[model samples]
Target: MSKRGGSRNPSSERARGRDREERREREREREREREREREKRERERETEREREREREREREIEREREIESEREREREREREREREREGERGREGERHWKNRREGHDGEKSGVCVCACTRERERERERERERERERERERERERERERGRERE
Candidate 1:
């Protein structure tokens, strides 16, 4: 009798099964590659974010340093003003002592009328000097404000 038409070839079936398994493995490998690529992208984004944060922090530090420097300059200017005021006071004291000595000498050597006139002239000169000094101090303060405001 002829072989039955429905009979299957066992070797051919095994070969087909092996083919399917290999295809599935290839697909699994592709999926793993895609997953690795996604993880790499995420890491890159995280690194970029960290860099941005660091740059911003550096900028903040620079601003703080500039503000501190400005404050220091202001303090220095105030100290200089105080020193000038002290010097002016010393000068005025010297002038007053000189005037007192001159008046004592004139009292012994000059007539009373001439001594009185000289005293008036010395008093007027001292007043004029005081007025000039006040104007100079005001001008210096104005200049200081102008120069410091821009820097």
Candidate 2:
């Protein structure tokens, strides 16, 4: 039988080339999409890690503030107990001085009053310092939050 057309026809060759080019284009598109997906996943993971870090920092700061508050409260309780003792001592000495008018008892009362005043002033200073620290922490927190855009 005579072959009507050879297997290597020019039109068939052009069509096969076009098919191969089309397949290559589709493969390139798929690769680009996969790369984009991978990049998106990486960015998501990075964001999650950054969020975890910020949360840890916040937790640490809270713990530190709580610890400081506990220490301050302990100091306050101790000061109150000391003040009560001083008051009781002053009253006892006053009664004794009224019985005999001792100059030494009067000097002791003066010293206790001075110490009490000093303690009150120190307490006020400490409160002011604590307030300043809290304000600074708040400002820092605000800055941090503003810098990080939440997801």
Candidate 3:
């Protein structure tokens, strides 16, 4: 009877051990699934961050292109202004040459000389201001380039 009872006891103990092992296996599978989900979420977050960074870079590039266009326009305006001044000077010289050589001493010639002197002084001042503006623009360009590099 004692031997029979001991044999029954081992069989029940083995059944309980198998049930515990199965539960442990199920828990391990759940843990593995959780780990996979966490990794997936982390990868997704990283991908989003990369996309945001690219977007910021594109925006900055667009701004830089716009700024460059504006600078080009400003330079064109400056060139046009200088050309107009040169044209005015040339026209005046031509007028003076024609008037003095072809015509007799005229009142118009006196007025023209006085006007030319005043215009020359004003032109000198404008040229100085233009030079200052050019210097300032060059400095601004250098600074912008540096800022773009940093950003």
Candidate 4:
């Protein structure tokens, strides 16, 4: 009876030791799975952060492009305005030149008319004096007419 009881105690101890080792192996596998899950989560978060940063950079680039385009348009408009103003000033100068030419022509024509009137008056006075001398010399003696004409 003592030998049987001792053999039974050793068999029961061996079974408990096998069960403990199996339990330990299962726990290790569970820990490994949890670690893998944690690593995957960290990788997913990093990828999302990178994508967000890229999106922000793209938006900033677009804003800069828009601002540059607006500045170019404003500069072009100012240049056009200056060109128009110069054209207007040139036109005004031309008009003033034309007006001055017209005034000079009018002054020359008035001077020519006054010179013609003076020439006509001098010719009429010479004709009237020649007629009066012919009337005073009617039927005079030859020698006396010659003396009076000379005096």
Candidate 5:
């Protein structure tokens, strides 16, 4: 004779335990999947940040190169202007040498003309100096802007 509801069935108890374990394992797997997804998102975000940083660096390098090119152009222009001034000086000297063979009155007139020409050249040189100063100021301003960008 068995007790009516006092004894538990062993098979039923084992099946319930197995079902609980399966549910717990499924929950653990879901947690692991969520963690993997989070890690993947973080990796993607880091990659994007690196790419953006690289792009910005490239742009900065390009700007620096452009500034250098502009400075080179300015130097070239100054050199050309100096060469032109030297050629003019050579021409004036040649003229003076020829004037030595002429009469006194003609030589005096040539000297006066040379003096006037020197004064005109001095005035032109002063104007060019002012222009060069302005350009230098502009370059300095650009450098300041680049430094600000760097900062």
Candidate 6:
């Protein structure tokens, strides 16, 4: 089998060169795919880290809110206790004032009764002196008047 109508059989050389070029192109394509896969993996890791940080921040905020609520409740309880103490003191003071007023009224009434008794005694003395002066002026009738007075 002789090569037909070919000066140098250049077809074989051209075919080999084309095959080598195709192999090189295939290798470049595979390398590009591997680089894309690596980039995707790095992006996924970054996203996971960001999500974890956000969750931690949310937990911290929740703790702060709980602490603030507890503080407010404690303050309210303290205020209520103070108010109760004040009410008790006020009631005791009112009772003491009422007792003082009652004692003063009783003392005033006793003094008034004493004054009335003294006035009555003075009036009786003045009436007895007037009767004695009238009896001296009528000595004849003094004995009969004295008997009448005794009866």
The number of the candidate with the highest TM-score is 2
In candidate 5, how many Å is residue 27 off? 1.1
- Residue range 1-151, candidate 2, lDDT tens digits: 6556746678988999999999999999999999999999999999999999999999999999999999999999999888788874576556544444235545433333344556888999999999999999999999899889663
Q: Quantify all predictions' global Cα lDDT against the true fold.
A: 0.82, 0.81, 0.83, 0.74, 0.85, 0.74
TM-score of each: 0.53, 0.55, 0.55, 0.51, 0.55, 0.48
What does the lDDT come to for candidate 4? 0.74
lDDT comparing candidate 5 with the true structure? 0.85
Q: Whose TM-score is higher: candidate 3's or candidate 6's?
A: 3
Q: For candidate 6, lDDT tens digit of each residue in 3-89?
A: 677576589889999999999999999999999999999999999989999999999999999999999999999988877777625
Report the lDDT tens digits of candidate 5 across residue range 39-121: 99999999999999999999999999999999999999998888788773576566654544445555433343456567888
Alpha-carbon shift of residue 85 in model 4 (angstroms) = 2.3
* Pairs of colliding residues, candidate 4: none
Error of 5 at 138 (Å): 48
**Best first by lDDT, ranked:** 5, 3, 1, 2, 6, 4
TM-score, structure 2 vs. true: 0.55
Error of 6 at 147 (Å): 94
lDDT at residue 35 of model 4 (Cα atoms)? 99
lDDT of 6 at 64: 93
| Model 6 bad stretches (over 4 Å) | 1-9, 89-151
Measured with C-alpha atoms, the lDDT of residue 46 in candidate 2 is: 100
Candidate 3 local lDDT, 21-96, one digit each (tens): 9999999999999999999999999999999999999999999999999999999999888878887357656665
Score candidate 1 by lDDT.
0.82
